[model samples]
Target: MIDQEDVAALLGTEGPFARELPNFAPRAAQQSMARAVQHAITERETLIAEAGTGTGKTFAYLVPALLSGERVIVSTGTKALQDQLYFRDLPRVRSVLDARLKMALLKGRSNYLCLYRLDQTVREGATFDRTQASQLATIRTWSARTRRGDRAELAEVPEESPLWPRVTSTPENCLGVECPFYDDCHVIKARREAQEADLVVVNHHLLFADLALKQEGFGEILPGASAFILDEAHQIPELAGQFFSQSISARQLTDLAQDSLSECNGVTGAIGLVLEPVEAMQDAVRRLRLAMDALPERGPFHQLEAKREIGDALHDLREVLAALTDVLASQAERSRGFANAHERAALISERLDRIAERDSERDVRWYELFPRGFALHATPLDLAAPLRAMREQTQAAWIYTSATLSVSSSFDHFARQLGLEDPQTLQVESPFDYAKQALCYLPSGLPDPSARDYTDRVIEAVLPVLHASHGRAFLLFTSHRALRRAAELLQERVPWPLFVQGSAPRHRLLEEFRHSGHGVLLGAASFWEGVDVAGEALSVVVIDKLPFASPDDPVLQARLEALEQSGINPFMGWQVPSAVIALKQGAGRLIRDVHDRGVLVLCDPRLTTKGYGRLFLNSLPAMPRTKELANVQAFFDDEVSAPA
Candidate 1:
């Protein structure tokens, strides 16, 4: 067994990483985290390690995990990060260590192309439009040649194309082992590889899906690993709430109706029983969405009852779905396709009934409207209990690490959120010299974030900073409204290229921004974290406000009310800590490496106006602070004139 000392030696200055990798710079922080992770693995202890930006946390964990020779599952925040770790980082680490470890990458089933669905679409000649037909043809061509069938590999097809849904399968639609293409199933292949591998890379969604399965009676998708390292672990609490929550969407209902009709194509006399009710169910869904148009985008379930039309529409939907469920139940013995459809229909009907019952004490029943559809959710008020239960059931070492895990140097809030009772915690500060490489500039004289003209004022203040930095900056906003406004105002003013979020795929926009050399990118939410642009390409990160969860959200409102009822100051106990963590994520985008120098422009007046602002400030990397715009300009000025 590899001990903590062995883990340390591999990461030390004279170790394999340092000797073999040309760009690997040894840091005491990385070694410290490696040892901690090694210790956690050896003792099978719960560890919460907060390695700040530039700590090389990836290598820190990988070394110990690869050396420990345990069946390890590494879960990241997103599919992109999962791919990065598996396809890029893991191979490098294994090669350097010469560790003979088998590793595999697994994602949610939706990511892989379902050959069954593809063939069904092909045989049915289901073509919505010319573009969709072309896209499907492209997928068919690529599907034949692709080994993994991961949709991410097909660069020719855009992620948002409607054709993807027709060709890919969800849990509700998958025929599983009964499928004709079961022998060639990509998802099963991926899982089989993961089950046999020593290490598996996955995203949090897949990890939580497995955790959620214990309750769902669907057994886990992941291998029973000896250790689970959840990198970007800060996303866990919020994500756990989502995975744990029981949600049924309009799309699911419509898909069920459509798939039921598709299943009737071959079966004799099936269409007569299924087609009319399926269409009626589809119509009910449309009526429900139309009725919901008069209400707020989302709110407590009671709001549906408050509006008589919406209530009637929802009732109509339920009756039609129940009718469809009964019909499908009659056809269940006809074919595997019928059985799957029947099961999905019955399950959704049951969920709708369960969601209808008011469970205010534990779960919050809420509904959210979309442009084309809607979703009803029943989220738990207390996520900690379920989360803790998941960890205990695994009986494996749980190591949670992220740059933004702790708030104001305290893990209490995060710990309480995830029910990490006295888990061994470690905070390794970023090895970057923040004093020399970074500056924090809090803009002065801004109205409250609630003010109607807040976005306008923020842009007015940021334009000059953009000019000073020569347009190499990320203008991150808490809301899309602010981001759009800023983009509109700067399009004509800024001389450099402007890359706005939603204008293109995130990766493409980032690539353009990086290559532009002096580009101003306006983004919201997703840009806050897991984005890396080091050196001179990015020199400034301007946050429009403190990254607080909007109180308008149904989940946040319900959570806060629950906290208030429990005698906690919801703002300080929950909101403030969460926002501080978010701000750190946004600010972290600025200084990514030791050589990277940049200015973090915090436009939120609360940082100085409120007492709790210190929490946000303290949580950030220590950097020289100033309120003067001249200071920000001077910082960049020095960057330009400094010796290379």
Candidate 2:
């Protein structure tokens, strides 16, 4: 029998924590969230929660999930957390509760090492140079010893190695059970573990990919769990939008073409059927890349722009792909690999034609160009219908929780966006003493955020604060260009271990930052959220400007235009709330633990000057605000001088 009283006691102050450790103190907010989640699971209702930082929301949800006797599938935002959940937190909780449970962690296909692809690439002699040959040799050695066949186990092989794709599988290229090496597939083994588990943890990408699989009648993970718990749930609308959209990229096409050619080489009649079309597709991809190179840096292009000169190129490429599809169709039945390739080519051809046609009223069609390639996309303006359909189709309870899910403690923005109907929302504030833990510092007399010299001025303003904090600061920027500019200007001026994003991997940078004793890490959007640091190592968080989603982005523009058509104020309805949630995330970095003390510096003057600025301020934790550098220095001084 499951015990509710025991659940309450474990979450209470004088319960397991109080009995186990002298330093343990229970959080009421965490207990409240636990009760709510338990209630949701009991009633099988769709629920939303905005549990702030330090609420111990993970355990709050996990404890109830374990006790409820419901098979729960917990979805996180990243794979790093997915592994952490399975390897660390879940085991800790199980031990704490002394409950026996079977749990599994499942990531997407690409994370696993494909034995089939690895064997084919190495045995067929795909390497062209000595460096690649050496890399293949290293992988071969690792594969023999590795039990799980996870590529992450190979630390010596650099992340940027081109040989990784050859050893991994994509959805389009994976031959699935049809492959000769199906019995030994790493991905399949992982999925089988997940299917047999009482509880499974997955990332957001895998969750949506599974949802798509269910919709399309394919094998997937986490469909039959009794309850679904989404941590970092604010990302749902955006992630759902992506999965619901029709997208086909040049990279996917290129990879498919290359893999098809590689897989079909030895088969009879493969040369004429595969070689000619693969070469043509490769040429077309190069042409598209070359043509798009003339366009500006990565940004959205309208249908008219796509249809002009670039439109002709898309048409020509689609025709070539179409011809390839015809060639593959006749020979596909002979080989499972070639058949999958044919299906992918046909889908790509249809989507390209649809993207070029741009005739769907319900869908907003656009394309983005990268330096090397581009992708065409069609997103539904509203995801509510489909999202609601998904909720109805599944018998499981849906619980969405995140630190930044609310606008002014209301979940309407999040709920309406995802089409959840009357979701029971509970906003649990962080138990941390925010007033004592953090200070919001706005630099006085700074130019607008869009000014060309704004980064320089922000750096100039932050110099004094950085000095006070003794180089333990995160200089977070909105764009890479801004991060580069600020890093260039500050690295020479600051006498600290300066770690810039992309210098090393994100985790490595964070790890070094913590170990450095004193280091200033400059990073962009990725660092702004999902970063957790506590205590003296991080004394300040300085953001160059308020993180407003770029207006030039295709999704933002589409959303704005869609709102305008309906005569809703886009700025209030879309822009302001969205920016507020992001700003809250950036500011949230300052106060992680109850003992954490820092100044959150938003150098943008718009917080005080603009009419919509209060929304951002109102959304953040209610902390003391200041516009002076002296106050920040004094705050740090008082903390340093204070008794431990």
lDDT of each: 0.91, 0.84
Q: After superposition, how far is residue 232 of candidate 1 from its true place, in Å?
A: 0.5
Give one digit per residue, the lDDT tens place, for model 2 in 439-479.
88999999988898999999999999999999899999999
Candidate 1 residues lying further than 4 Å off, grouped into runs, are none
Q: Report each candidate's C-alpha RMSD, comma-separated, in the order given.
A: 1.3, 2.0
User: Each candidate: how many clashes?
Assistant: 0, 0
For candidate 2, which ten residues in a row score worst on lDDT?
298-307
TM-score of each: 0.98, 0.96
Best by TM-score: 1
Off by over 4 Å in 2: 1-5, 17-24, 128-134, 298-307
163: Cα error in model 1, Å: 1.8
